[model samples]
Target: MMEIQGIDLSIIWSIIIAFGIMMYVILDGFDLGLGILFPFISDAQERDVMMNTVAPVWDGNETWIVFGAAAMYGAFPLAYSLIFEALYLPLIFVLAGLILRGVAFEFRFKATAEKRHIWDKAFIGGSVLATFFQGVALGTYVSGIPVVDRQFAGGAFDWLAPFPLFCGIGLLLTYALLGSTWLLIKTEGMLESRMRHYSRPLAYLLAWVIVITCGWTAYLQQDIAQRWLHGSHWMLTCAVVVLAVIALYGLQRSLRLRHSHKPFVATLGLVFLGYAGLVISIWPNIVPPSVDLWQAASPTTSQLFALIGTLFILPVILMYTLWGYHVFRGKVQVGDAYH
Candidate 1:
């Protein structure tokens, strides 16, 4: 109920934070997916082209993660603290993977045969570690972080579970689909053809993973199930499912037709729809079972202060980001530099 200028800052920050999360998932998700798919491509030149595709925009893509975390800490201190505490181990590893991958990006481009190969491995491993942990964290969050007396009461490794593992695999597949579709948009000839060949399989895999994860979450979490099983919310859930299925179908068709942009758009739509459904299912809840968004929100003053900067700077960031993409649009080739 905290208000600022007649508007609820809690809801404002929540929307802003959700937007940041979605952007991070879409932007950084593709590059990390490309990194995960790196090792599978035997040709060194192919890897170079893949790296080049993301090079101009990769650093910018990752900025949203930092923004999201910091904003949550400022706007929803309790939820941020509890979620981070519950995910301490996984968060540490996620940071480490991101760092390792950043370093590998530099070294792999500069080193000779042997050292480059080693760095390449590092790049793949790092991306896998980061993306997997992110997915695990998502699953753990959805399952609910243990809370006692309004504070985190879970063990460090509480998130280490079969459901989280399955989620990790599912997220990895989803990201790979995004990456492959992006490659289709940013590549041509042999690499693009290879991506087209791979897109159908990745799409199918992602579709199943989404279904399984949705079923598991619904079955295990009563509130979430109820959200889907009753009321008009069920219609919303059905719409999301239908939307995802349509996107997948469209993606496959786009790949077949060699539509450079449609596959990427379709894949992004699936991710967006899935994300939207999850948010809808857990609307008021921040950390789950009982920690509703209002309960987890920070003071109105804090949110208002944060919004001053966010409201001003976010649009600027968005503008520049779009401009950068426009400048870098078109196919990326093997000889292009990482920058």
Candidate 2:
């Protein structure tokens, strides 16, 4: 394996993939949340304003998913192939939803006033479709995929289960919370107040979902249960639970205090803690219950080559993403046109 000093290149690549996925979830997640929130805001003008808040940077947010997928394909082909094969159905739906959502996002602006509702429905449907399946995919992954002889050995409908379906609901609430907090940052007047009102319930619901999901996950996966319930890892589990509670409390308090930015920041903290906890649970396993990073990794030379290019490209992506957000900073009013 390629090494920089003593660190395995596969490990380095895993971190890179993890970072990309986290960034995608936090960034693209809120935009998807906006689509999920469309049904709640009956006023067409308010919906437009909500969409505008994310218009400037939403497409850029999706780049991380592409980057992560490419990194996984190049750095860990075995795991990539197995995962994709196992998740082909949900992933296909995710892609279809994303395509529909993207099309609706652009076309909604050009659409006639009477016909705009069509696009709105499309947008909402696409967003919910994408987010739900993504959650299902995550839950299915966590529960584990059947693999044998270095290939996927699971049935076509293996992912259809109550736990995965429940996880779909959990992610919808999670993203809705993110969306409301984002609006708290990017809107004002009645809209801001409405978002604040919506955020409180979303936060509470999300907290419950997180707790239930964690418990369900532990019940289904004994290895994960042991990791969190026994040994030194138990301390990490406690820390994660405590930090999640603190973040949830901060989010609720920030909303109550009408601190616009604090609510979003706190939501981000909660999202990060959740992501971190997942990582802690499945450390060293790109494919859970079976494949470790090294076993699933590509050859050393392939990893080294990809790492070199990724190091150069990642910074550019970050720079441009930051610049785009900087230029678009501040409230998106009803009259504003970001598209």
Q: Please tell me which predicted candidate would have the highest lDDT against the true structure.
A: 2
The TM-score between candidate 1 and the true structure equals 0.97
User: Would you estimate the TM-scores of all the predictions?
Assistant: 0.97, 0.98
Error of 1 at 290 (Å): 1.0
Q: Tell me the spans in candidate 1 whose CA falls farther than 4 Å from its real position.
A: none
Which lDDT values do the candidates have, in the order given?
Answer: 0.89, 0.92
Model 2 spans with C-alpha error above 4 angstroms: 1-5
Provide the lDDT at 97 for model 1.
Answer: 91
Locate the minimum summed-lDDT window of 10 residues in model 1: 330-339
Tens-place lDDT digits, model 1, residues 34-140: 98888678898889999998888888998898889999999999999999999999889899999999999888888988778899999999999999999999889
